[model samples]
Target: MKHILSLFLIHTFTSYCQDTTYNHFSVDAEFGLNNPIYPMTSGYDAATLNLWHVGLGFRYAVNPKFGVRLSGGYDNFRELAGTPSFSSEYYRVSLEGVANLGNIMDFKEWTKHIGLLFHMGAGYSVLNGSSIDPNHILHGIIGFTPQVRLSPRFNLYVDGSVLANIYQNYTYDLNSTRNTHGIDAYLINLSLGVQYNFGRKEHADWVVIPENNEEIQNLRKRVEKLEEMQRDDDNDGVANWLDQEPETPAGTLVDTKGRTLAPRDSDGDNIPDDLDDCPFEKGSAAMKGCPERSGSMAPNSSKEVITMIEESEVKFETDKADLSPSFQQLLKAIAKVMKDNPSYKLHIMGHADDRASEEYNMNLSRERANAARTYLIEQGVSGDRLTTEGFGETKLKNPLRTVEARAENRRVEFDVR
Candidate 1:
């Protein structure tokens, strides 16, 4: 039996390696020896010749753990003590509840492809023979089966069951006077069978192993470290671990050392704050941080720096100093240049046309120069290096010959020395 079972197992798994047959419904057919016990005459010993049965069964599972089975079969019985032989045949029907031990207990992963089932049931048996009356007897059954998976629609299993009758008799001859209904009859059957499963693909082909706790923890820690390394709290290109200036403001450019770059000039003087001697004032590196001469005899200013400042000049309403949007954009550009060049200083000179009274023009021109200076300071240039002066109707780039010339003359000029 053991050798046969081992061979069956090897053949079942090797042949059906890729198949999973743990379906919800199944049909089984089996043939085996049924040994009768507890009702033999004085001289008769149980023999194998007349102790066989063949059965067909159907099973339905509610889940992996529990199911029900209904089966019917024919059994033949023989008494060897008679002069020739007394042969009788019985028909059996049964219904049993099945419990799968492998699935319910969640066995080792490799064992998932097999199932161990236990069952118990009750039914009726009918007897027929030439010397005895045909009658029915109540019986009970208990059994266990081990199943090897083959495919989604097939399996191989062995069935071993104990069939017990509550009341029975061995007396079969009318001439012999003997009791007929006092002894209990029991039948032990062991059968090899194949079952075909129907409906619904089952997960019985392979087993899935879960990751252990330590591995899961290690993965979580690795992910956390990666997240920390990737995060840039200050939004600088450098990550937090390598960043020297962690709190550097947003949009601030940084060098390889993660330090903020010296690129901002608050006074629009083309002088970066870090290098400018007077960071709050518009000044030049040559002057060691001092404003240019205010309307002096010979203006000491660089032609290039003066050109850049002149380009930033803004026009005004006849007597107002309020700047236009275009003029504001020019001022912003000037601010950037000043921040980049820390050695430069600005000279703000206000001029006007020969239209208003001298006093009024002078005051308006001062207001215009002061307005430009205030805007530069607000934009982050140094205040001490910036000086405002008014030249009313004086230093006109265009003469008052036409309205265009007059309008051009009413302007502000900037110089960097």
Candidate 2:
């Protein structure tokens, strides 16, 4: 008894000493009824049902699925009425192997509160009663316990067991001698009990260790990276993963790669290339980046040139800045007039319909004007003789929100000086 108490104390101390994911120790206490059968002298039968039976055990889990237990129990068997009455006291101590069958079979997949265990082992038992001396016996016991979890710390259980006694010296009545051989007696006990768990937040019996923890962790990292990539820090309609200029100013026009559409100035001119009449030449801003025009062409002739350029105004597809073959031909004609009047200079103005955001439309209009200027230059018109500007949707030729009206609005016209 002292040794048992010492062992219990050691287990308790160890259970509280370490922090772990799951607990590995538990203690059980139970009380119920027991019945004895066999090895009874004739005319000396014991009671059909006996009342006193109790058991206590300490368990240590080797892993989630298997463990061992040290257990002790006592039983009282009394003789039946109308017979020569006798009584016996039975005491037992055992070391049992325990299998967590519920975990092995994955009961958690179907139920959270139910569990089962199977235990079996061999032990020593002593029987003493009446005026008889104590009789020692070797016993083998097998049992099954079914349990329901009541809380994190407790489980309620019922156990049924069979103890087969070998080499018995006296009958259960304790009134006569019995065979000292194998399998001489049998005892059955039924008990209700509570198992108290110690150590850890979760018990080992209920923890399901993942088979591939590294793989799960890697997958979690990948999901986090994807979430980060999807964030749009500038709210520019472009994901961070694909945005080249993530911090572009609000309402600024951008391209598919998230770069600003504001045009560059190749020459050191104050005007951007899209609007500079002389993109590659350093010229005065007063002449629209062209060398001071030798002098102004005749006002009447400039008017005629301007009327011709306006009459041949080029229209573009919605949201498009590229010039069609027909529009290119019209630009060639205008370029010829500029050549004929060498002193004449043209100012190209671009416009757009109200189909998109202001900044987007503004960029689109500038590109249209630049396209026309490029074509005229390709036809031998000097860059310095042309100036360009964009009005976005502000100077709409047709204000009505109709397809034809919008189409008419998306055009480029010229003014001559």
Candidate 3:
């Protein structure tokens, strides 16, 4: 008996140390009636219903569906009125396995307040009375408890149990020893109780934890990344993933590809149309997109004008032939020079940076030269007087592999004779 008690205590201590998120321990107190049915002396009958039965127990839930309990109880049994008068006190201590039928059967789906439990185990019992020596016996007990939740910390329950004893030596009257040697006595108990729970707010018996927590977290992260990619921080029409200039100023005109539109320069001169004195005529920075005023300076010869055109070459974006308004203004100035010097023919040479295959760059450079020539013709220069050539990367003005040098090389240079 001592070894059994020691094992029970060790198991209970270990269970108490387990980490859990909800309450798993409770204390139960009950008081009601008990009926003792056997081991009475011949010709004596005990009461059909006795009084003064009480019990106290402690329980530990291993999980939501199962647990164990330790309890001690006392019962008072007395003889019927006409039969031989006698009284006995029964005391017992038990360690029992408990099954949470409420959890196992999923009672929460229908009701949150109702629950049930089944318990069974064996224990030591002692019978004591004034007329006889104490009789020691081993007893087996089984019971069911039906409970209703009263609050987070408490429950009301009804318990019914049957206890059967083995190897009884004396009768309930203590008049003589029992005739039978094994399984000689039995008792029935019915009780009302209240259980007080301890630990976290909700007990483990009711909480259900999901199994795929990590996968759900990863999915949330992926959704956040997609939302970031789709956001347009500058409020441009284009999403960040496709916008070439994501930080383009608000209200700026942009192309379908999110590149800013060129500022208006009607005459293809460097000056913007809004600021140019002669929006329709090509001129120098000093003249504000207009012809040199009369008597302002000595007249520039055709050769000097051609030199100025060559000095202010038309620039191109890398691998692109589209003309910006500022570059178109420069081309308009060259066209005017060509019209003024009717006897002179213009040669337009285009170059590219060393960033692509030789054949590809050659084609890109030719496209750039034609782009400038087309603008000159549009500005009223005779197409027959203009010639175009591509110099692919062989005549870079600055040969260093730097951003400024590459920008300098992507240009159209002009010569007139």
- By descending lDDT, how would the candidates be arranged? 2, 3, 1
Estimate, for each residue in 1-417, the C-alpha lDDT of model 1 and write its tens digit: 999996785555434433433345567899887766656555555554444779999776655677788999887766655444556677889999988776666755556567788999999887667777766777899998888878767778898888887555443221233445543677788888888765455533212322143576789899999889877889876788888898988867676547886575545678754455444456687864536656652222335445655665578867788875445556665665566566777888998888879999998999998988888889898888788899998778787578888879888888775
Q: What lDDT tens digits, residue by residue, belong to model 3 across residues 39-133?
A: 67788888887877999999988777889999999998888889988878999999999998988898888988999999999999998888777
lDDT tens digits, residue span 100-150, model 2: 999889998999899999999999999987688888889999999999999
Displacement of residue 303 (Cα, Å) in model 1 is 75
Which window of ten consecutive residues has the lowest lDDT sum in model 1? 203-212
Give candidate 1's whole-model lDDT: 0.70
Q: For each candidate in turn, give its C-alpha RMSD to the true structure in angstroms.
A: 23.1, 17.7, 18.1
Query: Which candidate should be chosen as best, given TM-score against the real structure?
Result: 2
- Estimated TM-score for each candidate: 0.42, 0.49, 0.47
Model with the higher lDDT, candidate 1 or 2: 2
Better of 1 and 2 by TM-score: 2
Error of 2 at 57 (Å): 0.4
Whole-structure CA lDDT of model 2: 0.81
Residue 318 lDDT (model 3): 74
